[model samples]
Target chain A: MESIRKLSFQTSQFLSFVSKNQILLMSLLFVSMIFFSLLAITFGSYGLSIVDFLLGKTSDIQNTVLTEIRLPRVILSGLAGASLGISGAALQGLFRNPLADPGLIGVSAGAALGATLMIVLGGDIFSQYSLGVFFIPLAAIAGSSLVILMLYFMTKGFGYEGVTYMLLVGIAINAIAGVGIGILTYISSDSELRSLTFWTMGSFGGVTWPLLIPVILIIALAIIIMIPYSRQLDLLQLGEPEAFRLGVDVQKLKYTIILTCAASVGASVALSGMIGFVGLIVPHLTRLLGGVNHNYVLPGSALMGAALMIIADLIARIIIQPAELPIGLITSAIGSPFFLWLIFKIKKL
Target chain B: MTISAKSISLELGGKKILDNISMDVRPGEILSIIGPNGAGKTSLLNVLSGNIKSHNGNVSYNNTPLESISIQERAYIRSVMSQFQSIAFDYSVEDILQMGWLDHSHKDIKEDLSAFQNRVIKECDMENLIHQKFNTLSGGEQRRVHFARTLLQLWQPANTKDQNYLLLDEPFSNLDLVHKVKMMESIKAKASSGTGILMILHDLNLAYSFSNKILLLKNGRVIEQGETKKMLSARLLARAYETFISIDENPINIRYY
Candidate 1:
């Protein structure tokens, strides 16, 4: 009885300590994300292992496969996941609704439409301007900015009833953007059509080191700028007037969050297509495990998002063995069920 | 030395919401603004709290224009709790209360729940509800939680030099009678400690009993503004509210027929 009592007391103490130190928990989660990323880099069709690479026993072909092909792919997936997760968490906080996500709000659809347009129609425009290869991401950013701007105006017009109207406007804009993409698909040549399909489904198979660099830079910049707004976002959970009276510059904060989310989601979609669910579910999971404080939810979502995406990409790569599945298929397959479960849980509460 | 609004006016969608209203909220006093529905009491509070910009004239805090002060700097001097406190997230009651300390530099949530915050929480009878999700609470409980949150914002420990302000809109609307008296007593105690409070109230008796100054608004205009004893006569209140209100003096009771 004495031994059992001692063990129980120690367990309670440990649980309390862990609950008190959220930064430590977040750090551990980030380390796990890094581990999973490295593990993901080792799991392509080629039989390369980290053990062999570390022991200096890797063949030249194996080394090239690991470093040149799989490394950038893994890094891109991680960045895309992190960006989506953080943006989703931020947007959810801004709207004060858990259902808000980058994909659901039409930002992803807008970016996909922009990239598709660039793929199908920008050849002549690029050649005329001598814009070598930067047109796709630039167009994606422009498209996202336009959609976010429209959302801002629509919400502003609705005044105090903005949240519900914002969601409706997002749905309408998403439907319209989908129609535009359909039109682009109809006019594209065979090769452009194939790439557009692949882009819409979202695959990291096409990522290379050169293309990953600028995409990583843009996403990194956006996420870095977004972390500081977590406190203001927390305040905003109390509604705009309350937040403003508590000394938040609500207009400025809203504009900054919208622009940052646009940049991050636009760049991620440009690089990896419209991978869904990472933004939606990862933040929910973070809040469930770590609480609703954005200081924890934001960084926790980034880490968990990176880990989940890396694992999803790994599954996408190996599930078909030489024939890769789209990363979006795996994420949605997992995400949709989790979302339903969340609804039921909230209802139960 | 006080928040002064000079000839403030607001028009929304070509409709006048507030028309040339001027008032003063002084230190160490409870000033109540009482009016009927659509009398623009809430809108006037918005203008004074800097949530809404007035179309004409200016609002100044301690002799400086309110627009010139940064939001972060203004947070140290004033905290407002509006009538509507609809929080969408399932944050714990403790989490909602801790958000009051957002402007403070304390990063530790446990340590930031200072002695004053605890006393306010205890005073509001929120000790039993602190661990529960805020959304799960009933309407009256939620109001008390938010009341405690607003109080926590201006609560300073062992320091009474700063002249802070609390702007509350219909704080006693959803509270029960017992809690309402408790809340009024707490507000009086805070005012006695040098914190200025401006509140909008529908209960005429409570306003008359607690407020040092009273402003009566009608059709977006001030009907009367003076000491509560002078401005709260039966004739003026009846005329402002368009109802027959009788005031009883010794114990301070009001009845509307």
Candidate 2:
């Protein structure tokens, strides 16, 4: 009896410790994200001092570069990273499978296919208008939603027996999408081909405030919709029968979360092209720090994701001066080794 | 409070798992469904608990149709402790207990949960195991801790009109003799305190000894059911299991010889 009291007391103390420390960590990370964003915006091929920019007394060249190129790229990277991380964490919880990610389920591949198709087919027609940029994202979102819808039905196709079939079908669709991407790359002209390759590799080179709206809005909406269902997700982790016993409408919750993930992944991919590991890695990190509670995992992942992208962007700038490396490469290089170490550490726990 | 499933039948994958099984339990009573392997004891428990749907007939609690109630509403009244639960992550025993209390419909019980938890942990002899990760515990220890969670579920005071339903599927399968007796006693005390429980038991002695009512199942059918002592007989046991068995009443020991 005394031991149980002690245990309960200890658990509360631990939770309190995390709660207090989390706020401090979030504040620190937030300040750092802002600092990195300013650094990324102001430092580039041409230097613009923060004081000069704030004073609105920038040189024409520096102003054009800051307003046109750097700011958009920095802000977009942060938004894209947040979206990928939040969506990945949410999907992991939704499926109760840690390996589950938007990339693995073919959502990103579908979005990429949609973008590739837009690039190849809309060249002359799209080049005529400013609507061209929005067109790719629209196509990507549409394509991702379509694929997710198809997978949803395929999973529900067998009426509860279809669940096991969902992941298998997801793998098949992902493989098919990979082939489609390969074929598209095979037929493109040099410049378009190189641009496509760079885009596929991922870049924040042309990111602007105009691109930020949809990405942030969709991610924000998905996160908002998902938070209220956090407790339901907790019940879900107990396994389906127990979840059902606890009054969660399993089918409805599953569909809603998957659609949310698809929408967020589609938006981020359409904007950023493709950034790997953020979605898969952030959730594991959140789980490590906060346990498996979705309430903490979802929001916590968003902050961590935002910070990670900014830091990655900062590293990309310093690595090669006057020449830039893709921020995506930095994340993968950093994320892969960290993820491997995480796997080993988790095994021990 | 009363929970009853009438003529419940379940079929899955073109195979009929349960056929025309009907059972009932009232508040302050225990019902033990006893049967051999594949006899649909677990299926019946599932049907009553709303974890699995019945193809035919209906389940009603306090005379209200079970299907009309939302899952959340049903959850407030019923909690099931299955045969096994496995998860890749780790959760402390106290954390699992909190999960149990968190599911209760009453909003006011949140503060009282810690006190009730202390009571349950003492009852289940889980004092030392409270901080241990659920997955790290032995099969028997996990069962006991889960049983403690189950007790918390059963002891919740449901809304006045709602009936509390407890479902245990082979809950004793992993326990040693001592823990089995301890679990049964805890369950009996909860029943007396107002939880209506339906459990599947393989041991006839435990079933006959603790249950106020016994359900004899054979081939997914309720072959016989009544007062525990009156209907528990060697003939019923042999017929239900389709095996030869002997019941010696002199010292009340049952053997297969």
Candidate 3:
């Protein structure tokens, strides 16, 4: 019993030690993610041997499933989650609103509308070409870019009023995108409606290596772009006028935030459809776990977001075996209640 | 050296908010801008701090055009504490204070960061509240935290070098008497240590007591500007404020009814 108590004390001590150093904490998260992902791959419907897979002795079918299907799906979900998480954190800091998220700002909705329109109208034209995978994602990016550009032009003032305009314009654009998506949904064919439903209720089942690479690159690029602005975002939390006075080029920072967040969020929506709540909840969770300093919060949110997405995807895939639930359904089921709990917890604090 | 503005005019929606207004603040001195409601005190601050880009005039900081300096470079020259700040997220007071630290807020780039952080916390009298959540703090405590953070930008471990500045807008609004006095003493200390100070003050008594130079403004135009003792009078204040006022020469006090 004494030994067990000492062991437990040591574990807690180690945990505290790791938590204090954010770089160490994030590195641990990253390593655990890799380990957990490899472990997760051994699960699922197909009978696969972890030992054989590790030893490179797995069968052809196992290799195909692991490399082409499972790996891409896992990676895509993780990337999407990271994108949403960092974008949420950046937007919240940029707009100086705790509730700011990619979904709220119309990036996802606009991406959905653009893809849905492309699917309903140009579905036959793109699918015939080998480069068809690029079309929908490109269209989605275009739609989100339009929204961000509109926001940029509309919020052409300095200080708090500019931030307020960004949020208001985001809401207006979100509503318009919603209407457009509704109209397109009304007009789509049976097959198109199937894809539309897939978009509405997000899934990670069908993604392949070809489709996943561009998205991973885009999200990786966007996150890299966001890293440099972490300090500026911290200053922005004080409000724009003060931020500018303290030597932040508010206009340039705003432009960078809008572009990078919109681009990453658009790419994620293009691939994963609509995975809500990760972006909104991840940053808040990161802040609660550590502190509100963006240097740590940005990477911490990304790592935690990827971990959460991996787990959510694992549950979504394994719970029903061969037949699967939409990733969005599971996330919403989990996220909404957790968010409500978080709200109450924060209110009490 | 001085932060000087020359014939600055600001117009918004075809209305002249500031009509050819000019003022100067020298290092190691406190310049108080006193006026009533809607008198363009905050607008002038906005212009001076480079927070407003549309103003038509020249603002030079330490002999360089304010517009020519990069935003980040400007923090090395001045710190501004504007009124009515509402933070969006909950962060520790320590984190909020850290926001004031620029690329190099310290004199020596290699100086230990936490040393200055500790000094500013103690200076602002926020030692007890430094670890608490900023949003959870009371209005006055939050004000102290912001003042501490604002001071952190121009944070000098001992004395400020020549040419840096502190611009405050109603910094004492929410503080109790104790904190007000504490903050007042610190601001006074900062001014004495070679930091030029420009502040918009509501408390005429406090302004009259500490201000070395006074600018009396009425409806965006300068009514009077000179040494505080000459520029500040019951008659000038009464005319500028459009109200009756009284002053006592003993120990420097002003009373408004």
Candidate 4:
């Protein structure tokens, strides 16, 4: 009798939670994201504080570590997480498939192949140029654009049959990229091999001020493009022709989704290599927490993703003192198990 | 003015789906396209709805070419319900239903979707489905919910020159008898409120009962068209369906046995 009463109370609480306005729910997520970001900045080997930075209490080296390393990594991780999360939400709605992730479009793998080729082949040659930091990212962008171009041609500007063709072409591209990466790995030197391994495992250690700017611009552009189309994405869940009848320019929507997703996912992979499961897990969490309306899901997923990625990065930093674990490892390790739990919970529902 | 199609022809996968079809649906009239299987009734409906753009002839909406109108503008003017609308993820029934309000900018509808909620839910028997996840609903329940959503898309203003249209394909397929009657009544009420209705129906009895106008199609061609009472002639329906159809008088019944 007590247990039933407790269950009923919890049910009422959940009902109240879901009934809250969507904007209020999203504001909660936004506040949480800010809270996590501020908290993450205070962590790491060289301890820093917002209070200390504000009061000018930190020494020069400490300030340098805070400014040059900690700040960039946290912001970049947040940006990359937001990009992946929103892109994942948009792609899932566009594909009308729950399993569609940022990587499903072949951008990340294509970006990986590009970065790997640049690292393996353009060693000291790019060091002579002033844009040494920009070379690998540039190559990654080029590679992703190549895949995007191919997809555009194959689908004929993303017409009615475009979604299916995109998935199939994405598979082929992933396979080809895997082979290319494998071949590059075999040819790489010991130091190159180590860097390649760490990069693929994923980290925010290499994040810097210069590299942050383009990523910021690109991801911001992607988010701006995605949010307004949230309703169109929701309509797409009704099916293509229904969306068309409802006045969504289906072809234009398809185009916007693929391109924005590619730009942001490509930039994220270029900034931080192969962060798995954040894309898949973040949007699913937002949909589960808030309702599945893309209006809430898109922005909520973005905020939740940024918050989770920062918290995960903090855990990765302090899990083993001095030696940090890969952010990708932490995300997948926690994410996959949580995903299973969600699936079981869904089954129960 | 009418939503007119002029000599529209569509060929898909080397098979003729609709051949030189011409028809129109006007505001406040329910036009039912009825035929046997493989009669291209759905094909004709698709062409008229502006979904099949590669068709041979022209489609005009209220005297303007359908292609000239932007999709966003057209969405405000018409609502379509296809044969199937399978959602990919778990959305509450409220979420899916609220999607119909995407293009609703009517000044009279001062509030959000709640204004029509009571009527829509009651008519479609969706009171229990309010907070439920859409994917978990039974097939018939899902159909009812979709019907509710389709009804919510078009509103009944007192008197408006600019009319909205409701296009459906086999909307009654998964509905039970009582629910079908209720849904048809809701559709008729929408029509009475000056909304045009164009639908493809497999059930001749329902078509004959509900529609003001009817088109009988056979093998990508119209076998007969015009007033529902006259166009549903037993001999004409027999030729269209290629079956032994009989109509008994006194109570007006049509049977193809």
Across A1-349, the per-residue lDDT of candidate 2 in tens digits comes to 0111111211232222134555665576678778878877766666778788789888888777877787777877787777788788877776666655666567777887787777677777545676555676777777787777787677652233444565577678778876777787778773443455554557766666665666777767877777666656766767778777766788878877777777777777777777767888887787777666665677777777877787687677767986778766877786768767856776676
Q: Write the per-residue lDDT of candidate 3 for residues A196-264, one digit (tens) a residue.
A: 556776887788777788788778998998877777788788877877777777788887888788788
Candidate lDDT (C-alpha), each: 0.80, 0.72, 0.78, 0.77
Superposed by TM-score, candidate 4 places the C-alpha of residue A310 at a distance from the truth, in angstroms, of 1.0
i-RMSD per candidate, Å: 14.8, 10.0, 16.6, 15.8
Compute each candidate's TM-score over C-alphas. Answer: 0.90, 0.87, 0.88, 0.88
What DockQ results for candidate 4? Answer: 0.39
Q: Candidate 2: global Cα-lDDT?
A: 0.72
The DockQ assigned to candidate 1 is: 0.29
Residue-pair clashes per candidate: 0, 2, 1, 0
Question: fnat, candidate 3?
Answer: 0.57
lDDT of 3 at B115: 78
Give candidate 3 misplaced runs (Cα > 4 Å). Answer: A1-19, A123-133, A148-194, A339-349, B105-111, B156-162, B250-257
* Model 2 Cα interface RMS deviation (Å): 10.0
TM-score of candidate 1 relative to the true fold? 0.90
Model 4 lDDT, full chain set: 0.77
List runs of model 4 lying over 4 Å from the truth. A1-21, A104-106, A119-135, A145-176, A185-194, A337-349, B104-113, B156-160, B250-257
**Alpha-carbon error at B237 in model 3, in Å?**
1.5
State the DockQ of every prediction: 0.29, 0.33, 0.33, 0.39
Put the candidates in lDDT order, highest first.
1, 3, 4, 2
